[model samples]
Target chain A: MDDQDQQLVFINWLEDHSASVMKVARAYTLNSEDCQDLAQEILLQAWRSVPKFSGKSTAATWFYRVALNTAMNWKRKDKPRRESQQPLIDINVPEPHGPDSSERLLHQEMIENLYQAIHQLPKTDAALVLLYLDELSYQEMAEVLGVTENSIGVKLNRAKKKLATILNGGCDES
Target chain B: MNLDEYRQAWKEDEAQMNITFDSDLLSKEVLRSHQSFQSMIYWRDFREVGVSLVMIPLWLLLGSMMSLPWTWYLTIPALIWIAAFIFVDRSRHPQRPSHPGEPLLFYAKESLEQTEHQIWLLRNIFWWYLLPFCISIMAFFVNVAWNSSDGLLGFSLLSGIGAIFLYVIYSAVYRLNQTAVTEQLEPRRDDLQRLIDSLERETDDENAGDIMELVAAISESESGCGACSGWLNWAENWNRLVPSWQTATAIILPTLAGALCGWYSGTQLQIPEMGPTLFQVIVGAVIPFEIVFFSICWSSSKKQKKIQVARDEEAASKPEDRIKTTSSDNGIRLPKAPALVILVLVIFLGVMAFVAIGAFFLHMKEDLNAHNAQVIKRSFHCTNRV
Candidate 1:
């Protein structure tokens, strides 16, 4: 494809599937800064990968594969540097506003707990949980992860169990 | 809440976190980043091949100027061989497949293949990169020493020293490339392999029912009152003082020591003035050092200023807005460099400027002396003819 056409397709895909990028970035990284970094990296990779879109797979599948692969590599590369330094402060959760503020706050807390639990799982399992949480079907997840549908089911069940353990463990401690 | 409710919340949060981008801006940013990345690889390839290409012209120029024997020119073909070898090898390996749209397993495997190829090139660098150049350089040195007034002893000594020096440099290059492969590339390759294995390996389905039951039980038993410990921010605190003096000393002392060592060696060897003088050598060395040092300091200061600005903005804004501001900044910034670093930089620049001025005057003086000698020789010839 020509550069303009390729770019047009990429921007549309990015707009359509940006949520997946954000979720993958959030699931893989520990902080907003790293999330931003990983998100930009995924975007760049996606932009580069646009010309290779063959219409064989859906754009969502292609973008997820790009983001997940980029996140996995990024996490591995950034591990040592992240481990060396201690964070000075925690990221502040945005205050819930308007009607049903308390309900929004509770949901926010659950989501935060969900992310923390996700962080504790193995990288691949974390990816599976993120895909599952995003409501990707077993077949879609299989295509993104390059595994059999049956394999996705088995691995994802195991990952979900591990995730539940972490979340419940956090709740009991609290 | 059940898994279905959690999915609902996830989708809700994803909606609330709706990030819109200006396609033009994003495209420009991506293009800029892609160009920078491509240029870095291009620069590295140029450095590797450009050196050999440059040596061909240099060899011819020196050969013509010195009136060396025809055999000395043979090294040109050897130099070409080295450059062509690198070019061909790089072309053969190519870059990682550009299509990241492939399955994760396939993409990871392609990446692993690229890393393994890099390791192979570095591991066998002696054959393609070093050996041909070594042979050409030795040949040139042997030809020069053979044609010199000093006889057999001088030839043997020159050839022996040349071989040893080349060996040291080539071996060091070999060792460094191997070290990089071991310390960096090999580990990355292994990581990719493991990732591929995990993706390709299927899990047993027998335990799927048990795991699903466990997940359901855990979800049903949850109270949903887990404390929302905030995510850790990645910003590093830059309030501590940097030991600028120690850093300056560490950089400056070794450079001065190396210059002194070079001077001492020159004096001890009573080296012939076939090329640059000590002053010239020092100037040549210091210019590159100053350029590199200044670039590093400039980049560091710029980075510090950016971080300081971001921090100031974050501090002034509401807590809820801080994440938005920082995330939009798109890069990690630290506080400005300590005053001591600036002070050291000024002093360093001042010293280098003084050295540079002195070298310029010395060069002018040499030119004036040569001009005077030519004038006197012409006058003597005129007087003799009269």
Candidate 2:
């Protein structure tokens, strides 16, 4: 397809799935600025990769794989850049917001807490947790993660337990 | 919270996630990255071809200036070998369009074919490289030996053995590269393949296999099997005999080396001016044997692995026979070393040492007689002077 046509399709997909990139960036980076850079990279990659999309996988699966892969690579590349000047920024800690229903606010707190727990995970485990939180099926997660289904089952189980421990504040025990 | 509770929260948050980049900037970035990616691939291929083209002429010039009659002839065979190597390599994996950017199955297929080609080169590298290399070295040796009346026989013997050493190096390199492919690359390739295969299978496309088979057949027909077909068919038995060959070399070479060192020390034969010191000869004989023997043993360990894979495949294909075959033979085991073999080796070395020692004393006797005659002549001269 022509550039104009491709861009139109990409804009539509980006509008739908921009959150996946942002989420992956959050997990990968140490700050909002790095997250912005990573998400932009993911968007660019997705645009380049859209032509090769075989439609063998769901759009979400494709987006998650692209965003996660791009973010992971950006983190690896940007590490030295970060280490040279500033201290590491913790992106997983939620911004303090004001005014919402108590129930909605509680759920938001739980989600933020869950992301914090995931952020502290090993990179791959964090990815598994992200996919798990998205409620992707084992097969879809396997495709996105490039992990075997059987291995994913084991890793996902471990990741869930780890998340639970973190959420329970088990590590906080003296 | 559990994922079930987290799902509602994700839905709410996802709605608010913004597209941080404007379309104009995103489009510019996308176009630029794609352009750079294409250029990078082209540069890689260009650099490889450019270096190779330059080196070919340099090697030819160096060979010509080498101090032997056959050195100039080296270029012809060298040229032929390079042409054949490239031809056979290309034919073995008919040049496919590269897919650097694709992921999953496309990546898998590309990676698989590239590695398979590498493995093929590793397998048959002797024909492309070592054989010609041996021939060139043999030519140089023959030319030098022909000038020495008695050294010609020794030269022939050493050159023939040298070719075997070249073959050993070829096998060791091939098996090493093969092991890497088996251990590391194959699993990733298989995983990607499995994913692709599952997707295809889910579509209930029964004819997918036939279509893929047809494509494979066409590609394979255009490509030779990366071997000298005639030689391969003839030497298929060599694969089975490889263990015995290693055993023979381990026992024979060390004894031969010891005998040569002993004979040279006895002054039985004049060593060649270039690279024929007893130490060099012994090391040359012993080292290649050691290299060949060790690699053969290493490759043999891989046989048990292959057997496991085979057993699994067999079980999958025919489940009824699984119980019976559980205790079946793993791939051809290296035969146990019998007592008689060790005894025979000891006897051979003993006889070699005896010959070497006997020659040394016999030569010493001649020197002693010559010394006695000189002493007698000196005594006669003194008596005449008085």
Candidate 3:
């Protein structure tokens, strides 16, 4: 309604979803420096586009869409980044007992594997997995993608199978 | 170990992170963009808006003073003010110089390139082409009020011929001066072009799609795409005629017609019986026509010759250079001896008036109108020597 009120809401929304933005940037460029630049560019575009935003889709969904589109279409004029080769972080595996310390370290390792697995999925499918993992409703994900809610479920299922196959070292197909 | 656990961890990680944005550098660059765009949009055009504001009051004062029913002497201030404003405005707002650091040779080349469009706008309109024509019209009305017996015939002929003469001289002089200016302006035009190009390149990287689309649109209107060689040829020869005595003589035809009318009027006042003579009719109609004919003929001849020469030269030159440099920078060459032609024409007109008076005296004597002949002779004697 007012400038300050609008700005506060936008900053709160942007800060809450910055990890999603960083994940999209990481997909395009695994190198930390390049990832930071890509993230900054996405933020700049989002800031410039803020005045045009109308209250239809939730801010988080809109932010997710903008970040995803930037990463997918990001054609760097300089050298393109190489595909990331780092091992995937394993987020789902529970630790076999050691101490609470060992359990926390295992949990961190699992979260790191999950992020690496999301980065490895083909760019579009990786975005679907990230949003699906965040528990975005199929309708909200569809609104962000400008597609039907049914398509979102189909894409999310496909993305999950793809991620699962990447995480499992091809031991299991979907 | 479950999908729900992974989803919760991801949302928590996103919520905990911070992103910072700094746009100061970008804002500064956009501010410094193109100079021509800067000047045209913000500075030079801004002054034009100022000029328009100043002009409103100036014109209003001028209109009130000129239209006010004061004695003829009171209008002199308004006339002087208008004349002064014209001179000041011309000098103060001389055309902006071309880019800086461009060679003098290139300046001259660009001058010639821009001559036609510049001259056409300046000569035909900007430099007040209509002012003299409008003045001549006003003069016709004045002449009518002063002497109704001669009818509108003499005044119309005089003004018509005079207007054509002024048009030729104005056009010629403007073109000639244009040549000189182009020679002086080479460095500036080059600098301006370079600045524009650099700005374009900067914007190109930042806005690739928008810049590419704009450049494509501009390329469509480019001068290089057609065989405009002939037009340049015409411009060059028309330029040559500017300084010639022939142009000056042509421009003075109206004054000559006016002088002839004065002489006829002086003599007719003496010999009333010879007022409607056949020679007078021929002189009145044919002389004005001849004056207009000579001015048009001279202007055309020079234009055609220039075109022919330019065509040959342009055909030999590289197509790319011809496109970039043609028609934009030709400085108008000022004519030498402008005053001499004007002075000579004025004197010649005076002499023609005496000739008309003498003819009236002769007609009266030959027709055996002795009283009228003596009166015509006395009037001619009293008038200063032709």
Instruction: Provide the TM-score of chain A alone for each candidate, in the order shown.
Output: 0.83, 0.78, 0.75
Local accuracy of candidate 1 as per-residue lDDT tens digits, A94-159: 468989899999998788778777877877788788888877888988898788887887788777
Clashing residue pairs, candidate 2? none
- Best candidate (score: TM-score): 1
**How many residue pairs clash per model?**
0, 0, 43
DockQ of 3: 0.04
DockQ of each: 0.25, 0.07, 0.04
- Pairs clashing within candidate 1: none
RMSD (Cα, Å) of model 3: 23.0
After TM-score superposition, the amount by which residue A65's alpha carbon in candidate 3 deviates from its true location, in angstroms, is 1.8
lDDT value, residue B240 of candidate 1: 24
List iRMS for all predictions. 12.4, 20.8, 23.5
Off by over 4 Å in 3: A1-6, A77-101, A170-174, B15-386
Query: Per-residue lDDT tens digits of candidate 3, residues B184-220?
Result: 3333344334423422232223121111111111101
Ranking by DockQ: 1, 2, 3
lDDT of 3 at B135: 59
Q: Give the alpha carbon lDDT tens digit for every residue of B1-386 in model 1.
A: 45667778998887776566566666665665565545545765787788889878877865665455676688788888888887887788665344556666676666777777878888888887788778877886676556542468978987888789888998999999999989977777766766666666686443222210001111101111011101112123221223355545654655565556556655665454322246544654465556545655666668777976776466334222213323122344333455345455547655655454444334434554576788899999999999
Q: Write the per-residue lDDT of candidate 3 for residues A1-174, one digit (tens) a residue.
A: 465555565566665665666666665554444454455555544544465567576776767766655454343312111111111111122334566667666555666768667656655566677678777888777665555565555556666766776676653332
| Model 2: per-residue Cα lDDT at residue B201 | 40
